[model samples]
Target: MAISSTLRSMGLIGRCFVHPIFDYLVIGGGLSLIVIPAVYLLADPPVMRDFTMLPWFILCSNSAHFAASTVRLYTKPGSRDALPFLTMVFPTVTLGVLTLCMFEADVIGRYVQLIYLSWSPYHYAAQAYGLAVMYCVRSGCELTQNQKRFLWWIAILPFFKVLLVATSKHVVAWHIPEQLVWSQVDWRGGVNLVTEVLGVLAMALPLVLFAQVWLTNRRSMPLISLLVIMTNGVWFVVFPLIDGFVWTTIFHGIQYLAIVMIFHVRDRVARPENKRGVVFHTICFYGMCLVLGYALFNCLPYGYQMLGFGAAESVLLVIAAINIHHFIVDGYIWKLGRGDANRRVVETVAIGTGA
Candidate 1:
């Protein structure tokens, strides 16, 4: 509900490190201004890249980050209030049934997979939009009702366009079956034309929005707000689908983790029952995610295979189900508006100082 700096008596060096926007990006988003352009231009070096997926650390870590953040929502008290049964039952049923279908019914499996891919960018953009507005309000960039409405429209359009692009081009051969295609009228000419134009607009909108925000708020508008919104451009507009899966997703997870953990730590500290220290709580939080991630990623496949499910289909189904659950949970948990209790989770303050 209120924005305050996180800086304390650690002086100028401390100020640089302690600021909310800086900490948010560095710790949560896993990026800074310096890292973005370098990443855009850089490729994986010739040497072995990092961990499981090779050529990148992101591949191994992203799923855990996402699962961990979703688990954070469950642990947060707000989720229990906002229609607890739908939050608990819907995703569990979806995952269970879909996993069965993946093994038994190929047509349904493909459909579910397509839906997940189609919905992913919007889910991603939503997080960026929420964070952007939070930063905007924190910095006191007040806008008229219409202006705020337009801001959301701007945040949404790029991902929406990217969805169209996906539909036009269709999924790659390896990711899905030929039956899963979106029947493009003309693969090269008309479809490419539409996709290219959409791609250009998706890339351009964030920059346009950046200019508009600056014109509207001048120096008072936090640069971090603009940067958070533009992160969507990097994710949806710039990279190819597979590479974007690794690069953009990890950053998104980092951004989500940083903010959610802040909420968790704050809430934990506030509760009388929470006797554990921050370090212990942090480990417990992330450790749960890692365990869940392994189960979702590895255990699902093996368990399904043992149960006579198709290995590839089972993996895809489990991944989609968890992601769909995440999207649903996040929609409830981070519904930022006036008088929302979730607002309590993200309130900013001077680090080491009370509100």
Candidate 2:
């Protein structure tokens, strides 16, 4: 009888947790599960051969996102105006380009494809969600100033990741294998310099904006935001300058874990009544931390080659894990926001006042 009751309660929880607009959690989680194993399997090959498999994983993951967005569009047309359309459209277009470039014959083409695939899709998706959250703030969603600040920080984290990877590559040139250093010069002519400068600008822009927001709205910041800022400060600012790739990657992984935990806390606060939502967020939060922890512990110190894996293969696995967690959390919050909007509309109509 106790077991039966437990099963029934679980069933009820699952039903209540069903999202009509987008099965983002399932899609993201499923693709991540598949992509991780596929990457591991494909990693045991020649460098070129291993690199060849990355687009397939990226294509699959991006395709899942595109499908989820399409379903979201169809189910809730009203919510379309809330997010930036370019966020979705650009990823679709870029993913298409990446798909084509994966098959290209030239080495340079593959490198370009890898860079875009690394940063663009998630960058845009985070931006879209950030835009949605900002809309919530504008519409009086009750988010603390700190929450807004944290979301803004996350929205621009990709730029930091790019800069950190590039700078680390340069600063650790002596430790890196001779063959792995593709570009010799720090700043080159034309496109290379442009890309480098843009990277620096992108990384710097978020810090400037974060400082401005904090200064303008210091009183509104939440404890979680403060913690996130401190954690990110240590990883992005303090540690990277002191350590090289091994320690930096480990610390960066910890920072990423903190971000996930902080967001989970925010999501819970945003919808305390939704127990199932809380459970889902908790599952994703811990699950991501577990997976990433395992990867960093087993994969980083050894290096991709030491694990008998190519760089592209290792990147694909790590990215799949991180992106999947991000997608699930973002989708969960978007659905929560939609539900909140509907409740507000009902309340306003019944009360006969917008307030």
Candidate 3:
């Protein structure tokens, strides 16, 4: 209690961890991205083994948060305005078929995994960018068109490097040793050369973007924004391939839960359209995520195995397929257009008209 009181008295920099910036950058995914590896690096051998697999497995199974958010977005009345039945229905069927194809044909499954793995980095980066912009505006930063573009591109650049390098033989994620590179394009230089060049650009461009942010003063970069973006770069360096996947997914889940829950609560309170009481709705939202998370993340894979898809292989494919589905569903849902549920969610994070 004394320790927490000392912490509370530390003011904005300290308190920001729990408040306006919490969902946007600090605790949700961003802090864990740092703390997990720090502890893992400091632990002894036996402790390290516990760090290796168990935490990651638990985290991976917690993907129910993503499902919970996605389910709410779709389940809400009139969400279909932002996303049509065709958009939602087609991907559901197609991804399911693709999952089945993985059992039947190796090539199809590999591509499915490839797309999901490749998209994961970009997805993380994009979420960081969104939260960064929200916090930037909330904290009184005013961004012009060019400045926003620079920030956007810089936020995306690191993850883009992941996607580009992933096109060649390199660390993918999970148990897989190599990511799929496109077979068709023959570079005048070797593929390694292309990846090397991209890497350099990725490193240099963000610095340039930051300089521009400083120079123009159109919008000051929020401290939270910097932390969020920096965490992305550091996270990859700390855990390049294997444990990286687990840590990132967990962080992503926490981040998603924080922001989505905020939106859910806000929507329930602010909108007359909502019929359920705030406390009931909030409890239901979290309860669904906790229960559904296990079912989707743990049970679904076992269900696949029970159907004789080969336990090990089917579990892998099930995860890959679910991730792909999450990506597709999420990609369409978060646009900040005119009146709709998604717009409301994004608006809740805005200070003014958004930086």
Q: Which structure among the candidates has the greatest TM-score?
A: 1
Residue 316's lDDT within candidate 2 is 50
Candidate 3 contains a number of clashing pairs equal to 2
Candidate 2 matches the true fold with a TM-score of 0.33
Cα deviation at 43, candidate 1, in Å, is: 4.8
Which candidate model has the greater TM-score, 2 or 3?
A: 3
Which runs in model 3 stand beyond 4 Å of their true positions? Answer: 1-21, 24-30, 44-61, 75-77, 86-88, 163-211, 273-280, 345-355
Candidate 2, residues 185-280: lDDT per residue as tens digits?
Answer: 433355355545544544454455445543453322222222322333333332233332322233333323333343344444456474566567
lDDT of 1 by residue, 1-355 (tens): 1222221111112111136555556543537345655755685522223435551344336666657656776787656677577557776776668766775567676666766777677787777778766655544455556666766776776576666555533356435543455443335466557766766765576567655654554423455555666666666666676555555676776677666666677677767897888888777777787777777776877887787877787677787777777787777777665555456544444323221
Instruction: Name the candidate that leads on lDDT.
Output: 1
lDDT tens per residue, model 3, 286-352: 7777777677767877777777777766777777776767776666666556776656555454434
Give Cα distance to truth, residue 20, candidate 2, Å. Answer: 28
Q: Which whole-number lDDT from 0 to 100 does residue 60 have in model 3?
A: 38
lDDT of each: 0.62, 0.39, 0.61
